[model samples]
Target: MKALFIPGNSPYPIFSHAPLATAVRNAGHQVLMGGIEWVLPNIASVGLPPVKISPVSMEEVGAFMGAMPEDPLDQLKAVGRVYAEIALDSLERLLDLADHWRPDLVVGGGMFYTAPLLAHQLSIPSVRLEWDRIDARMYDPGAESVLAPLLAELGLDRVPEPDLWLDVCPPSLRPADPVPARTMRWIPGNPQRPLEPWMYTKGDRPRVYITAGTRLFSGDALRDMARSIAGLGVEVVVGAPENVAAELRDQLPDVRIGWVPLDVLAPTCDVIMHHGGGGTDMTALNAGVPQLVAHPEYPTEATRRITEFGAALLVDSGGQEAVTEACRKLLDDSSYRERARSLAREFTELPPPAEIVADLEQLVAARA
Candidate 1:
């Protein structure tokens, strides 16, 4: 089978789809990445080479997010309008790629990358790929629910028949609030991150991992956190990307700072610090370490939500004082470590990635 995959908005695609692509490729299918042209660095950052197909420029979507008048509702309305425009642009590109790749089916992870619309335009089946509960149920009446009705009004069908709305989030993680059942499915994700060296080789002192990712990687806060923790006599392994690490490293020269892989670094560390991307949350849980999170909500929605569940610490990840205090508290508290381990056990109980992939493949086959 050949598939053209439309990716999510954030860097999640790199970790999420990059591994998924490798697995699908190993399964004997050709997969073409379709969202790279819009967010090129995101593709390049994750080390995925350019795919043959080009995506509609994300400039309009960026502009749309930029030009929206501050209100959340207005921003959402703007998104749906811009979604239509972007979908049209994506359709033109997909049509051109189809003429070349001629994929067996088209699959997208998350919204409006034009997969469903593209499939609609090309008379082929398409599935909306969901990674978070928010995107999975964003169409209902609650916070962040606006896209479905708006899309319906625009005459674009958001629903896929024969039960096609699907998600990668595990059902055990679903909220108590009512959720849409038809379009949802449990799909576990693992990027198979290369484990870092320091993890397997334990040091005399306990280990702590720190990263705010891109959303709220305040240089000052990170440096203070490092300095505060470095003095605690524990070995701190930070996997901060180049941009975030530069300033933090300058402040905490004593701390071991480098681009250690998460899969490798996470399991080694006794605890972690991150802004809470879903992938990061899962990684930390799987590694069975305590987490300290600090995100200010724009791109931090995933972080903030995960924090509310009590699985990790919602450290302010902001001011020097907040970072310092949060780190010290988590380091000293035994309860935080206990909760983290419990969450890791639940994450472990979830279905493996292969079963999740089979669910999606089955959905597509059943549709056909």
Candidate 2:
């Protein structure tokens, strides 16, 4: 059977979908991943056949969405609208591809609204893959509000719910009321580079890995955080995109600044500090590294759950003192590491991607 996988426009969510898509394809079924031009490289990196469904990049959509609001609710609304706009822009091309490809199933990333619409239009099953522990449906109200007209245009009242929702969140970090989903282990599929000795090996000093994620962060803030982390007598490795790494090269002569793959770097680190993007957060958690998240509550549910689980701490500001104190606390207090390792153990107990694929086949066969 043929399966079409549609992930979010951004690189992180696309990475989140890779493990399962690869699993399905390895099971001797055809898999085609659809994305915008901006994320084609990310799709290709996962060794999947990519079909570019839209010329627009996520940066263009972010420009359309304008400034992100400080209020988390408004931020969710804005994010919802952004995904809706992406769907609106790509729907035609997506439908055209669907007509030609005729996939028996469509597996969508958590926030990619277009996947459900495509499945509904084609009368096929759609599966929703959670990018993290959070229930992504929290953005639905905002998305559906903007999507109403398009729904009317398509003669549908609402986007159909997926036949299966795969949850990759560890049970310990899951929200009190999560969407009903099948538990699947989150196998990190972070893009890799040729590894050097430093990446895979740990030094005598405690090692800390800091990343702002693909969404990017101000170099000044990252520099301050790096310095603060370094002051604690730990080795600091700053993982960033090329541009950010270039900006930091001279400023942080003593620190390691480059694209260090999380799957490789995270295991060696004593602690992880990042912007709290779902992929980064889950990666460190899976690696059993205690985290120092910069935001107080952006990805609401996951942020709240992780802190409450005592695996991570929230740094309210980018102040150097705050960064140092948080990192020090994560390093000094052993409980955080214990909790993180507990979550990592939970991940091992969950079903692997291949098992999820077998279950998916059964679901599809029953429907057929």
The candidate scoring highest on TM-score is 2
Candidate 1's C-alpha runs over 4 A off are 38-85, 132-166, 170-172, 178-196, 212-216, 247-250, 299-309, 316-318
Residue 358, model 1, lDDT = 64
What 10-residue stretch in candidate 2 is worst by lDDT?
212-221
Q: For residue 318, what is the lDDT in candidate 1? A: 53
lDDT of each: 0.59, 0.84
Assess every candidate by TM-score. Answer: 0.75, 0.94
Clashes of 1: 4
> By lDDT, who's the top model here?
2
Q: Write the per-residue lDDT of candidate 2 for residues 168-246, one digit (tens) a residue.
A: 8888777677778899998886778898998889799999888765332458878877887899999999877788889
